[model samples]
Target: MIRDILYTLDSPYRAPLEITGFRFGKGEKTVAIVGAIRGNEVQQLYICSQLISKLRALEAKGAITSDNEILVVPSACPYSMNIGKRFWAVDNTDINRMFPGYDRGETTQRIADGLFQHVRGYSYGIQFASFYMPGDFIPHVRMMETGFQSTSLANLFGLPYVLVRHPRPYDTTTLNYNWQMNQTNAFSVYTNQTDRIDEVSAKQAVDAVLRFLSRIGVVRYHCHNGFLASVIDEDQLYSITAPDGGIYRGICHPGDEVTRGDLLGEILDPYTGDVRAPVVSPTEGIVFFGYAQPLVMEHAILYRIIRRLHG
Candidate 1:
């Protein structure tokens, strides 16, 4: 394994900020995996570190195939990570929203530019991504429906779900969308948690990546055939929102099955502890995501369910 700084910038108050990458095997630029663009994405970072560890063992044993290379970048924004901030510490900007970025633009843009330069042109690009909201997701492989997206390729990861999302205006600036536009097969792997490490899901993610690599002949690792992924469009999800701002009390979690009108959660008055609203399922389906935080605002999305289809 070869460890190198992928990009670096001078810091006025402290040490230079560096984005590091670990390279395994030699030859073709087969795959690039990124993790933790946001500081709070502890799970994403953990998954990448575990991937690096596993790749190191595979490389040491000559398990990595010749003529194929894999790059694992564990963290891109360590400065924010150091302070436990979610975005850039100085400007409160998101590195993820500055992709395919401008070299002469703001700090996050510059960092994105430098990093994208190094990661682009790979056969595949995989990002361990977190949700925009505080929630838990059923582990899935998500792709942007950028015309270049291939659900068949996404299924190789073997995750339980393959979500194809339609890109909005702001999505054009994201790493996954830009990678797809640039001819790279890009995928975003979402595990259950963002801020905290979930070992079970992390192992599932690592094994899924290994399974993909082995299936593509990049490595010789053996792993079980994961789920035959259920391909779902992002629009198909049923979103349940909080009716009033209050303390949230959720009874169901991601991956739970619920029937129509089932009690998913309830909102209580922050001071009085009286029930403010009861959140219920509108359709029989699997919980794809559930808000994990204890407090919520009115109209805040509480759950996203994958509505079951009848025969």
Candidate 2:
């Protein structure tokens, strides 16, 4: 395993912060895997570490295919992680939103620029991504609907779902979108949680990456076939919103199958224990995402369900 310091930011009063990459093998076709871009993505970092460990063992055993390079970056924004902030601690900006960036621009942009320069032009790019809102998600692989996107390529991971998202204007600056614009095939892998680690899902994520590597001829490790993977577009998801603000008492979790009008959860009065609103499923489907926060705000999105298309 070769450790490369891809980018470094000097601290005014402390040690310089570095974005490090652990590279394996030497070759023309490269696969770049990125872990945590945000500070609070504990599960993302943990999954990458497990991937790195497995890759290291495979490398020692001569399982990695010759001339195929794989790079795993465990953490990119360590400063924010150390300080317990989500975005760049200095300017409160997201490094992910500044991708394919400018070296002479702001701090986060420069960091993004420096990192992008090193990882671009790869055969495949995998980012262990986190959701913007705090919640739980079923393990899936997501791709922006860039003209270059290939759902067949995403299915190699064998995750439960392959989500194709229509990119908004702001998405043009994101790493995955920018990578596709630059002629690289990029996909984002979303595990179950963000701030905390879930061992089952983390291992599932690691196995998915290994499965991809094996399928692409980068590695020769034997592994089980993950999932057949359902391909879904973002618009097909039905969102359930909270009607009143109060303490959330969730009865349904992500991955649960629910019938239409089933009682999913209830918002309760914090002091008196009276139910403020009873949240129910609007359609027969599987839960794709569930709001995990204990407190609920009025009109906030509480759940996203993948509705069945047929009766």
Candidate 3:
């Protein structure tokens, strides 16, 4: 195992910020795994760390293929993580939204550029990604609907779901999208939690990565065939929204099955504790995501369900 600083920026008020990467094996740039572009993505960071640990063991045992290389970057924005902020501490800009960045643009852009220079050109790119909202998700592998996307390759990870999302204008700046544009097969792996570590899901994620590497011949390791991933388009998900702003009380979570009209959750008045609204499932399906925050605003998305098809 080899550790090196992939990128660095000298900070005026603090120690120099560095993005570190861990490398295993020695030849082709086969796979690159990234974690925690945002500060609050503790789960993402944890998963990357676990991947690094596992890769180290594999490398020590000569399990990694000699002609393939794997790079694991555990954290991209440690400064924000240190201060408990989600975005860049100085300007509140998201480093994730500045991908394939210009070197002369801004702080976040420069960081993105520096990191991208090192991460791009790999055969595959995997990002331990978190949602923009605070919530829990059913573990899945997500890919942008860029012309380069390959669901067949994504399925090798063996996660429960493979979601193909249509990219919006803002998505063009994201790392995944940019990597795809650069001809790299990019995938974003989403686990259950973002701010807190979920050991079960973390292990699942690590196993998934190992499975993919082994299947692709990047490493030699034995792991169970994960899941025959259910390929779903992002548009197929049913979004359940909050009717009123208040305290959220959820009766179901991600991966739960629900029927139409089922009372999935309720919103209560923050002060009086009276039920403000009852959030119900509009279709019979599986819960793909559930809002985790105690408080919510009107029209906030409470759940995303994968609508089940019936005869």
Residue 137 in candidate 1, Cα distance off native in Å: 0.5
Model 3 has an lDDT value of 0.94
Per-residue lDDT of 148 in model 1 = 99
Residue clash pairs of candidate 2: none
Model 1 segments more than 4 A misplaced: none
- Indicate the residue-level lDDT of 27 in model 3: 88
Candidate 1 residue lDDT tens string, 173-270? 99999999999999999999888999999999999999999988999988889999999999999999999999999999999999999999999999
Candidate 1 local accuracy as lDDT? 0.94
TM-score, prediction 2? 0.98
- Segments in model 3 whose C-alpha atoms lie over 4 Å from true places: none
- Give per-residue CA lDDT, model 3, range 250-282, as digits (tens): 999999999999999999999999999999888
